[model samples]
Target: MNGMWTFLALMMMISAQLQAQFDRSPWSFGLLGGMQRTHFTGTFQSLPGLYNCCKGFDGSSTSMDPFFGGSIRYAITASFGLDMQVEYVQSRGELSAVNTIGNALSFNGSGFDIVEAQSAFMMSWTIPSLGFTPSLAWKPFESGFGIRGGFTLRLQSNGEATGREELIQPKGVVFSDTKSTIRNDRKVNFTPTSLVYGPIIGLCYDMKLSESFTLTPEISYMHILNQLIEFSNSDESLSMSALRAGIMLSYTAFTPARLVEIPITPLPIIEIDTNKPYIPKRLKAKLAAFSVNEQSKEENIVNIVIEEYSSLTMTPLLNFVFFEEGEDKIPARYARLDATDTPMFDIDFIHTPNHVETYLHILNIIGKRMIEKPASIITLTGCNADIQKEKGDMALSMRRAESVKAYLEKVWNVSSNRITIKNRNLPEKHANTQTIMGAQENRRVEITSNEPYIISPIITLDTVRTMNPPIVRFRPQVETDSVSTWQLIAGQQDKELRRFTGEEKVPAFIDWHIGEEMSEGLATDSAIVYAFKARTSLQDSAEIQGMIPIEQVTLHKKKINRVQDREVNTFSLVLFDVRSSEITEGNAQIIEFIKGFVKPNSNISITGFTDRLGDADANQRLAQERADATAKALQVKNKAIVLGKGNSALYDERYPEGRLYTRTVDVIVDTRIDN
Candidate 1:
């Protein structure tokens, strides 16, 4: 049939198409619809040998009908797959015949009984067949196009057959012939129920609409192989064939067994945790300092290794905490502090609370490295920042270096064998580098490795040399590097006293021993300051500054006079403005609380606190100044201790009211002590 030729032609054209397409997955399914024409074939069983009127394939026997249904597909591999479909394919047929035939009476020999003839007849057959078909399909290439074929079980339901004959009798045989036709209303018929088996074949192109859907266009053909006619008194059959080209739209639940891969680069792993004290991002940047641009081909990050870091005194990459503007002796009060990139000296910065904190943190980090690799050693090379020092510079640098070495051994319990300290004090070897920026560089202790370098072990001398010597060289040191809880019972936050040099339970305070002459007849208890320090194990030596609290006065009363009655009074001072450490003249009324509660011998304690604002260091300094000025304003002749306990949770900085609460000093006085 021409239809078969067209189907084959379509197959040939599309099979060579650009297979550039969406990937087909393992399974898919969708709907289908299209149209087809049927070609019928059958014979009359009544005659047993003759073909029926509409039995043969011709112009009148073929009809077009709708086709619709759904399909499913399974992909076995990249290029091979199987598919199946169920669809509605049906055709209706009608054949009619009308004719006028000449009837002659040849009466030359025969009498009047010879001439009875009919000249007109009419007949029709209506065949409407509905079918439910199923199919199996496959594709040999890695494309959406494929071929499918299977059986159609057709139930021919509505069919009819009818015929009529007419006679024309003229008044005289030719002039007035009466034309008559016998009419039949219900003519052609088919068996109400009959199973018709047939084969169907199609060329379908499976097109993907999206991940889960597909569309298919097909050219399909089928032949009904069974006879399908049931007329009373007539055993006739109609075998039908169809040539159809249909476009079916389908949706498939297609899931691919493999997906296109995307390349990814893993980020370098560094430990980060919210709950734990962590290396801040700034510190990480400093630790990962690169001398080269990011676009460069060279790898800039030095691997962090325990063995390399454990054997060297790592100078903190941080600048030294410098002494305050004028006075120095660590602190004349608790101990004034100074900053240095160098290790702590037994001589100076050990007394500085800030310097002590910094030193502890650095050591904790170093100790952490050493702890990770127990078979490691650290070398400490200490140098003073002041290259201009004519005297005691070398001694000062050596003392600082030795202090760090001793700390690792004593506090962290690292074996002294794992650490070696060296003094680099020669002016020729270590210069002041005299510039402000360079001066801090000299103040810092430099570190070197007995093992290999990792983490780009910072390589430089503690002091820059005035002149280079062939015999002496500056070595590299790998420096590997807060919730406040303060509840004031009196003027001080009651804290557990920590030991600086001993294992015993340290006393709260030791007497100042300023003696009777210095008392100025005020009869005040001399204040004594106690050195406090707490040591603990660390991966990197870490101490949150606020974790351990300090107070305005920690010294216990002398108890020389045991007055049984101890009168206690508490007052809140809210006189200061934001970022200001001065008490205003209008707020002099706050001093009245002090005057009312104090005995001449009362050990007055004044502590100033601030809201959590700005940098922590600046906030703390402001607090201290405020407390001192408040004490000066009170004009207390007795021994008075002023403390600045930075920020307190007593106030939430989120609102003005909470911040006002924090911007106050708390005072507690006991009038019961004997003067």
Candidate 2:
């Protein structure tokens, strides 16, 4: 025992020394040897006809046995393994009778003496067996401590039993021997069970002894489930339990280590001059030329020809007012009248020489005409785009018509019965449905009058003006290494007329139309001034200002020439679809109207324009194609000046409507009236 304790201490020291280097192997083989203490339970009986001292013995006994085994292990994972052990075990047991007999013995020589003697029976057995334990092993922590659980199968060889009688009291009386062997070694009456099975549980600790060897100390307990011995004469059986302690020396097969190589590259070095100073590139801008109609003449004067006329009549106002999608109210651009304001609303006071302005007051015009001619009736038909949010929405269409009717009834005092309101999915003369502009044009209210004159165009005697070289072109030159953005703002003095802005680089040329910019009112007859500004990404800026002279005609000179009345009419045909020069039905009608005003002595100007899309050269060709198509459709006899302006936006290109309006052909007809 002392040597055993010393060996355990030495193993503990070795385990501590090798703990860090310990690595469990996937396959291991080992040999194990141990001492086991077996506990015998139940009953042990004597042979049926051979017992001399007693019949049987009951209760339990404990004895020491020897067990030697070899194990093979397979690791399923880092912390779990399967172990199978085959062991040869020798088992032994002893049992004594609980009750002792006290008998009287008689001596013949004395003829009347009596002696009391007490005796007991003892029984013992031995079993030599081979045990197979297949178990699951688990190492729960990083340390070597582990636990194992499984069942054991034991196959027993033949076993032997013996019985003895022992004297308990009166040892020195008549009998001299205190103990006596009543039964010698004999085979058990019944054969020991051939096969035995039971459950076993164990604990172990692994101690590394070398690079490939591990020493494990383990303890286990097995409960025998079957009888070891059975008696034929009685209902007697025997069982045993083993508590075992052992050590295993195992050899672990290890795999060899491998090495990998990697390549390295060197970086290039850069040199710098210490005394040099760094300077950023500079930005530059120049107002190259602010001229009219790209003209290079020194006197860039825009001629404003104010023509006097005795009477001028605008015939046939457009009958449709367009609306936005999914809307029931009239657009704000249309002129509206209140009940109080209607009494003072005179047709002459509201009439404008501009056709677009006159068209905006169509509702008021219809209402005023209805008030004048009470018998005249008109119909208002509301239409929708018939797609997307407005698809099949008859109620919304009706509401839109009602909105128009309500305006005429409330403001103009036109009787509701005199005005008929109707709704439809789309206008009879619908534009291209696939395009956005076409869809927008379809959402409108159409007006028709019973009397032709009621909805006819407004006629007024007024003076009109035209600009010579109508377009004022500006060219700016910017020089920079990193100029981010630039802007050109044109105005008369302080009021900005038009502002053009762009990024990266400024365009080669920018144009401003005099008639269009001065539509509100001519601010000055002297000169038009503009400012050009440019900026870099670094916030550096450059600015310049320039002015263009204006040639103005006085109003008195127009009165003197009033006898020679001149009529000027302008019309625009809007192209909605991109890269399309085909004249739509509506545009064809507009061209017919233009042809009606054309005469042998008429001065006609037709200019075609494209939106800011596609390459400049392509747009130029497209504009020319549109102009040629319009000219051919008109079939005018007189000579006409036609031009194609490429990608020069006449309207703001940022909005869809503005871009749609830019793709157009403009025709202006100036006729001299013989007095």
By lDDT, the best candidate is 2
* Whole-model alpha-carbon lDDT for candidate 1: 0.48
Tell me the TM-score of each prediction against the true structure: 0.28, 0.40
Taking the tens digit of each residue's C-alpha lDDT, what string does model 1 give over 1-675? 999999999977775442323344477666767777766554442222223332222223667777777667666755555666666554565444333345545355456434544333333455555566655677765577787888877766665655544445422344133332343323434454466777888787867765465667789878767666543444455567888887666554423344468899998999768698755322110011111222333233222111000011111122121221121212222222233322343422221212223333444445445655687766777665554552346667666667666655665567878878776553223423544433443454554445432111121212111110111111111222211111111111333222223222222322211121222221222221222232222322222222211111111222333423334455556636546776754346556545766677666788888866568898899889888887777776247778898866664444333444567766656455332
Candidate 2, residue 228: CA error in Å?
A: 59
> Model 2 segments beyond 4 Å from truth?
1-296, 299-316, 323-325, 346-359, 431-439, 454-461, 466-567, 572-597, 608-634, 643-665, 671-675
Worst 10 residues of 1 by lDDT: 304-313
Tens digits of per-residue lDDT, candidate 2, 483-565, equal 78888887765777788999986888887776566644553575767888989998888898877766555455545555455
Report clash pairs, candidate 2. 316-457
Q: After superposition, how far is residue 144 of candidate 1 from its true place, in Å?
A: 3.4
Compared with the true structure, all predictions reach lDDT values of 0.48, 0.75
Best by TM-score: 2
